[model samples]
Target: MSDTHLLICGNSFNDVDRDRLSTAYPAVYVDAPADMAALESGLRASMRAVAFKGHTPFGAEAMDLFPQLGLIANYGVGYDAIDVGAASARGIAVTNTPDVLSDDVADLAVALMITQARTMIRGHAHVASGRWATEGEIPLNRKVSGSTVGIVGLGRIGREIADRLAAFKMDIHYTSRSEKETPGWTYHNDVVSLAGAVDFLVVALVGGPDTKGQVSREAIAALGPRGVVVNISRGSTIDEGALLDALEAGNIAGAALDVFENEPNPDPRFLKLSNVVLQPHQGSGTVETRTAMAELQLANVAAFLEGRDLLTQVN
Candidate 1:
């Protein structure tokens, strides 16, 4: 059998990173979980690590294929797709690329907020369709600056978003597991109260079961008709049904979403809404940030293989 010890799974990994991993280790590449069975025949028993990058579920059933596997280094900060509990039970380790992508994700969140508030998409369409020649101007839109904004989950990315918004002189509010030491920002114990207190709500929470549906129907209602929602975090963080119903009924003014519950192909209902701006989960897709994430992922894998401490261990 070959001495391949690293199995790089998922199609999301760029060619540059794939080549780098191949050069650095005895690696085998497979596109996704469905293709794993076919590749299993050739994989060496020495496989000890997986450089995972896709959204497919990697549970105990999948892990059972490789008896020697010890580490799963994830390319993205969010590892919801991987069952860390199962990894732990098997005496395996898990690592993710965190702080490296925080700035980029936060920048996208702020951009989404501004885009939705100013109706930037519609304005571009109006100009492109030559309506600007016929109509005097696009209808006046909501201003983002000087607005009251609430940030949910003030971790690394959340703090970055809040800091950027502060430059616009907006009032910032946040909810976290514990209160922070920011005297200028308001703190809310719950998401519902945070929603009620702000003109815009930006979600920057982590993904996983703990955060699932944290933004409830009541929180959506609290935002009222004039409020806008911006989410750069995981889609499961919000109640999708409530958000869809609210958008349809104009309960909130609009939403700008980077992630979705069912991504790449989100619910068809979202595509029909004119008040919404949808993105295909590209918050950290910039060339610089993606390269950094890939480097960090590889660094963690190398650390585990070389008997060194992991750069960003989650489990």
Candidate 2:
């Protein structure tokens, strides 16, 4: 039997990094978690680690396939798709690439807020479609600078977003599990209060059941008309249905979303909205950030294989 100790899964990894992984270890590449069953015939029974990279549900059943598996190194910072409890029960360690992608994600969050506020997409379309000459000047858009902004979940990435927005001379309001030492910034005990206090609401919360739909209908309603929402965090962190309803009813002015409930193929409703700006969840898609994430994932896998301390171990 081949000593293929590493199984690389998920379609997010690029060709260069895939080649690097194969060259570094006796690795078998599975395109995605869903294809694991079909490729089971070719998988080495001695596989000890998995380099996971997608948002597929990898549970105890999948873990059972590799009796000797010891680690699941996630490519992204969010590992809610993986069953951490199941991994722990099987004596498997989990690690994710965090902090490295924080700045890039934060940058995108700020970009989305600005893009939505200024109606940049519409302005670009107006110029490209020759509507600028035919229809005269584009309509005035909202200003982002000096506006009051609310940040949901002030963790590592959240803090980065707040710091960048602060440079825009905006008032920062945030709601986290605990108050952070943010001088001059307002901290709300709840999301609704934070939403009501700001012109823009940016979601920076983590994923999982606890935070799923953390931005509820009440929060969206509290934002009210003229308020813009920017989300760069996981799709589940926001109540997509409430957001859609608000957009349709003009309860909220606009939204700039990088993540969605159905990513790469979000709701068709979002397509028709003129006030919304959509992104294909590319917050950390830059080459520099992606390369760092890949390196961190591989480092964790290598540590597990070499019986060294796992870098960024989750459980």
Candidate 3:
């Protein structure tokens, strides 16, 4: 067998696979804690292939440094951080774990929507801070049941969220470039109109230059005072400053966010707001989901070695 080369940028697989990769391929394991800078030297040494996770960016500039790279498979559904366009231009195949994390991320989106709608965080804090009874009855919140729900993107996770909300009898509407006939749900051609019409707005759009800051101030303003916003997609999809302005000015009721613009470091203003809920971009964090993702990455690597097209091609 001809020697195949691979580089692992994150620690997802077990120790056995790490050892196996070294012997089977022209492999390199990046063990450093620092960002992509720390991995530059190791990635430069290998010419045949590479696999990475976390903040090891492979943009146009980064990809230019490695001419021999045949494939790049990410460990998560969203490959926003990676420059897929650049890789495509270079004739490299890029893949991500899509179906594996759809359900998990959908679940988180639904939960965050309910949390914000019901004011669950404020309720928990009231009791924990020992002011439950003395607070003169906590504020009332809009019920999630029977609300008009709008989704920004109607892709995998967006469709899943629509399916789950059916049990609540929610009036569901979604936005996409094209129209799709989803049972019991309506599709909106205009995202701003969808935002205006729905009582709850959930963001499920992908992140890239095309979708970056797509949810503008006008969209948020259209949602108005009684509506609540939930984002389970990339943070760049929404204008963070616009969202904060809406929440602070009571233009919208509240927000629940699972992703941030510059991940690992959300705006500090988000932490100080009582009308919003935040998570550290953990849409697909379940053990089962993560294992499935790792397995897909393995399959992608195996396919690349055998001169086969990627099973889950991105582009």
Candidate 2, after superposition: displacement of residue 112 in Å? Answer: 0.7
Model 1: per-residue lDDT, tens digit, 1-315? Answer: 467889999998879989988889989888976666676554735788999998888888778788888999999999999999999999989999999999999989988998998899999999999999998698899888999999999999999999999999999999999999998899999999999999999998999999999999999999999988899999999999999999999999999999999988899999999998889899999999999998998898899889999989998
How does each model score on TM-score? Answer: 0.97, 0.96, 0.89
Q: Which ten residues in a row have the lowest lDDT in candidate 2?
A: 36-45
Model 1, which residues run further than 4 Å from truth? 40-44
| Model 3 global lDDT (CA atoms, 0 to 1) | 0.81
Candidates arranged by TM-score, highest first: 1, 2, 3
Task: Give the TM-score (vs. native) of candidate 1.
Answer: 0.97
* CA lDDT scores, all candidates in order: 0.91, 0.91, 0.81
Q: Give the top-scoring candidate (lDDT).
A: 1
Candidates in descending lDDT order = 1, 2, 3
| Ten contiguous residues with the weakest lDDT in model 1 | 36-45
Residue 39's lDDT within candidate 3 is 53
Poorly placed runs, candidate 3 (over 4 Å): 1-4, 10-26, 31-46, 133-137
Return the number of clashes found in candidate 1.
0
